[model samples]
Target: MRKVAEGVYRVPARAANTYLVEASKGLVLVDSGLPGSENGILKAIAKLGKEPSDLKLVLLTHRHLDHIGSAAALKKQTGAKLASHPFEKPYAAGTLVISAPRAWSLYGRMVRKLTTLEYWSLKLFRIIKFQTTHVDLAADEESVLDGVGLDGSVVWTPGHTKGSVTLFLNQPSVAIVGDLLRARRGRLVEPLLMESISQTEASVKRVLDLDPEIICPGHGKPLPASKVKIEKRIVKPVVVAKKKEEEEDLEELTSGLF
Candidate 1:
């Protein structure tokens, strides 16, 4: 819930995670977790010595129940500005709509059905005791969340979802790759939400070119870049990182120090 980097964090929630990106003005919340998460997020914020005004922006990695189940409620309660990729706007507005992906799987079929359940929960979350919110800040392909102190853009890394995006931070190479890339208990793996392997692999390579210093994801945990050293663990992305000089630094200083 607090800033782990210049303005990035992997906030823990009820079996899920919400990220907080802090900036000069305040902090930006990324993907508010399930209905009752705001309380924990708010408490975490308070631990940072920030008030309501400190929460300036609220961004979503995508519009999944576990990811943004609290978007609308947070806006109404915290008054934080919401921002997301245009592809994710409809989802936040309570619009459950998306084109069928090129690939389909039994697992995806099950997860896809959760949308209806999520919608009902969103309504119940607001009326009952917990709550959710709509996405107010929607951005396109190269949007910058300066409020989060991110001098980069949100890349369209679909596959997990049409709107699945990754925040590409610059200067020192940091990428906030949501569930698309997860490191479970320090072991990285391709997530279970993948809609198409082809698209997911392609999107990963796209971000690898940046020589990302660290990859903080929506599941598992953050990749310890300083210790592990690499953009992403995917074979293709790592291969791309090794092949391209733009990402030559991806090579870890292997001297048995790690």
Candidate 2:
């Protein structure tokens, strides 16, 4: 685990990332990472001199398997309330399975293929199924985090997922964005897989408008907001044909397991 802000710590849980926020009431976890990640997260809490019960809430940014995979285990062990957007509540609770994203470009197509393969692999092998966990708070709009003992708010930022949300801390001027924007090769860029490019663009602008000093993403290292550039054109969908050359160009970006 590494410190991102004064009271915020980032724990790398398998492929995804989980954040631990020291709140007034107790510790609030941002995302639960992948399945079998609860053990690492629990150890992180212990390293902070806190026990499992110190966890007050598990805030899910979206319904993606990597983001909420360990939510059920964490909530059960810590007795913490789980929170997510209303659109994600059912999926998180195991009522509905998440669908594959709309692929607009070569990178997006690669991601879609990988996602489909991963889904089936998990199901066929019964390796790690997404365990359902009830969502206590259905955050649809700007929700004050004080209710969960944090001096921040969760802003609905859809695109990457219909229910994706970004948590902003007022005092530290930080935004914990889950797959809303990824830090890749020292720059912040839109995620490869998204439901709608238009919605993703709009959400990116919303987060930039917040003017966070530090932006912490779900996949990579935190970056200073000033160093981040807003390339409006990049968010627009590119009409890339499924050609051999185009696929090779996106090799680096599509290398991750995301």
Candidate 3:
């Protein structure tokens, strides 16, 4: 766990939990820790001597089960605003995207219990009816919550997921990159989940061009600017699905879990 800057506490747990708990606005949890690590997050926050409710925003880089495992639980307890990219909303809302046979095996049959890789990493939710105040941010657009603690633009970085995002600061130039990078206990790309292999390659190059001083990856240790090397050129992701269709999925993911 690396503190990129003051008030920005980066906590990477077993699978790399990145929480950007701030002081100005409140606690901005970049990505909620794993389900089992929820209470630990609370304790760690307490250790920092920051009020738990300072937690305002819970920005999800992508909608993987590990990333959003305890998101609903945290929102209920802290009333934090759970922000996510339009692409990942559906999976987070508890409607697992069970891939078709071959795709399912390759991607992850998350709907079935004890099947998906994340299941081994974290136990599947029985009810998974956790609730939160959802906030969907656009990929091309930038969301600046002034009064809130979060002070950065959300950039769309697909590859791991079509709508995967990265929160970057203009000053510190620290990026809270989700599964887009490998930095924690494990060193590899996001476990076998891919829509378009080409898109993932493009997104990796996109973050490098930003020239961020700090690289806050989703699953491992954080790297400094000098550590990140662009293996390819940056190219804007070609969003495959229609915007309207993505919006509907986003609403359902954030609104309710049926």
Candidate achieving the largest lDDT: 2
* Deviation in Å, model 1, residue 168 alpha carbon: 2.1
- Candidate with best TM-score: 2
lDDT of each: 0.65, 0.82, 0.62
Q: Ten residues in a row with the worst lDDT in model 1? A: 97-106
Query: Over the stretch 1-258, how does candidate 3's per-residue lDDT look in tens digits?
Result: 456676667776535576664636777777776565567677667877776686777788776656776777777777777778766777676555523111112123333223544554333444443333355443334444554745567778887677788877766677778877665333333323455446666776677778887777776667775665433322222232224435655998988865
In the range 27-58, model 2's lDDT, one tens digit per residue, is 99999987789999999999999999999988
Candidate achieving higher lDDT, 1 or 2: 2
**How do the predictions measure up, each by TM-score?**
0.72, 0.87, 0.71
How many residue pairs of model 3 clash at the backbone?
A: 9
Q: Judge candidate 1 at residue 154 and give its lDDT.
A: 74
**Tens digits of per-residue lDDT for model 1 on 1-258?**
544566567788754677776666677676777766778888888877788667987778876666776676778777888877777777666556433332133454455445444454555445644433456656553434754565677778886677788877674367777767777657655665455566777777777776787887777677754333323434454334334522332444453466
- Residue 133's lDDT within candidate 3 is 31
Task: List residue ranges in candidate 1 displaced over 4 A.
Answer: 1-3, 97-132, 141-144, 147-149, 225-258
Residue 64 error, candidate 3, Å: 0.7
